[model samples]
Target: MASYASKQLLSIAIIFFCALGHLTSAQIVTLEVKEGNSTCIKAELVARFSVAYNTTNGTRTVTFPFPGNATVGNRSSCGGTELPPLLAASFGDGHALILRFSINGSQYRVESLALEYNLNDSSIFPNSSSPSLVTVKTDSAGILAQINTTYRCESSWPVSLGGGSGNASGNASVTFSNMRLQAYMLGSDLSRNETVCTADQSVTTVAPKTSPVTPAPVPTVPGNPERGNYNVTNNNGTICLMAYMGLQLNLTYPSSVQNKTVQEVVNLQPNQTKSSGSCEVSNATLQLRDDRTNLTFSFTLNTTSNKYHLSGISITATWPDMKEPFSASNGSLDYLRGTLGRSYLCSAEQTLVVDQTFAINTFHLQVQPFGVNGGQFEAAEECQLDEDNMLIPIIVGAALAGLVLIVLIAYLIGRKRSHAGYQTI
Candidate 1:
């Protein structure tokens, strides 16, 4: 029948759009910034949100992402030609993510972020009558800090931001995941998409860069750090942490209740992931999940200094034959230390033992406080192991060159002595 054929077509359409990833979700909600008569920027943001709320027993967390075709209301505000433009993606009940822009002469940047959530919304937060509007602001984390550049990332990892130090009463934590962005432009149209990010890599930093002329290129870090950008801001909008790096987790557990131990490798990347994290001053936490395994990384600042280091790790995983979940955790650790404002980079693989059954590792990794020039990683620090590896070749070449010079000098001296002995002959 004709009715049956129409139903089949509808089902096919749903599957196809879902396959396109977050891009399809944002396609229905478009935000644009304009200047005078020309459209300056076009953006489609597919963001995932996780909010922790108070429950009678304890704190419970809920994660929700805007679905495809969920843009039914005035979800976007993009028609403006003011000196500093504004764009917003609103999800009803006063929940929204708002971006404020600032322009100077020929350049523009994302000046601030304002995120709002409703504590009274029964659907978002169950059995709560806290009737107060909530708004969190990030004062000046310049997201698109470039001159006429485009920012695009469709990888599954999505940039992770927020976490740590939440209000004591209202919510224990809040986090945002840019599940994926498709061909988003900032300040201008896409001129070959200047900035791109994937699960294994990113062009990161949350600070804005300003210049009268063209801005310089944001530094590039290569060699498999698997770096992804992250930002954390307090209620005042001051950036507390900025980080980028690749993360890999190693889990050792019994394949079954009585079987021998087996190891599983999980890569923390955006292209294949469902991840969450929060950046805060003095402490940072990152979580990355791939396949059936999930990892939580806890980093802390040393009491003597602001150097951040990995302090703990926890993992949860599922196996094919197991009826119950498997988990492992360790809280006391000191690894991957670095200064607060700068980055730590190393090309050689390094591992940290969390316990007898679990470990964490990374190679070519870089991380820093995400609030610097254009939110880019600041001057970097090299790990000792990687530095040692680099030193080997240089030391060998220098030693060889020194021996050759020594031999040549001795030969010349001997010839001179022989000439002296012969005198006028």
Candidate 2:
């Protein structure tokens, strides 16, 4: 009888040990971050975590938060669940959780696989201000075409379900990758939490449409011809294209895409150099023309010292139809036309650092080869100096002569009337 009783007690002890081992191992848990949405440039982060139980009695309290100092809440459907008056977070709350997490070395690393991210927090989260998106394409091998950073209007925090251990000896761990971030508006009524759970369900779609770029229109006068292809080059290997008339255009290197070229007919705006701002083309000057006569043309070039230099060049040619006033019309205006060539010559007097920038000092460039169309000349004939220019001086001389004749006629008439009266007496 004693031996039989001892066997029964030993059997019971072995069962108890097995049950304890199963209980300790049964509460395995894992957490995952499901990305939330938001719109603010610097956004708060919200994530969802799921806790699963391998055994029954799987109840556990969860304290999840949006990554930043954000408030937390639950969906309307989850009424009376863990999120009414959700967690109010402060910057330094000892228990306040933040979004930045890492998972290389922590206690419970092995049991993290059974858990997943919960999808319930969509209602509270705001859209992402800058959401990262990935695009994959297939070539010979699968390739990633592009990765875009997008902005979303809303996002939420992660929800954790089914796992935790109150014992300090038990381990807890997580891995943060293939992850996303979202934000939520803090502080909503507690009643809404329960309603949010069952309210609605739909597949989340990427946001559609972006603001389109509109190029400003430039009004043009019908009859007046204007200059096009305006360009400027400084010695610093930089060439800026000047917006002609009331327009602004952007300059860029060859290797860019999208808004790479900003050509708009915007109202002319002045970029005045400030006293403290470093100057580029110190004495920048401009020449204007209406692309017609290449001979005697109007040109203005100014230097950094506020001094102006000008030249009016022309070449003359004789045509069969030329006679009197018509002959002078054949004279062509001489002007400089080649690109300022992406080269700038600094003022010989000053020293410049290798890559440092300085202002434009001198602007006047002389048009060499002054005479006939021999080298840079557009016409073959000698510059007509006399005939076509005669009209202005001749007109002035004729006016003066006519004025003298009028005065003399009046004096003679007076004298003749006086002599006639005397002779009659």
What local distance difference test score does each model get?
0.52, 0.23
What would the TM-scores of all predictions be? 0.43, 0.15
Residue 329, model 1, lDDT: 82
Superposed model 1: Cα runs more than 4 Å off:
1-243, 257-259, 266-269, 321-323, 369-373
Model 2, residue 377: C-alpha shift (Å): 95
> Evaluated with lDDT, which candidate comes out highest?
1
Residue 155 error, candidate 1, Å: 34
Please identify model 2 stretches exceeding 4 Å from their true place.
1-41, 45-59, 63-93, 100-425
Could you say which candidate leads in TM-score?
1
Instruction: Write candidate 2's Cα lDDT for 46-118 as tens digits.
Output: 3322221121242222323223333332211111234221122222222222222111221001111222122
Least lDDT summed over 10 consecutive residues: which range in candidate 2? 351-360
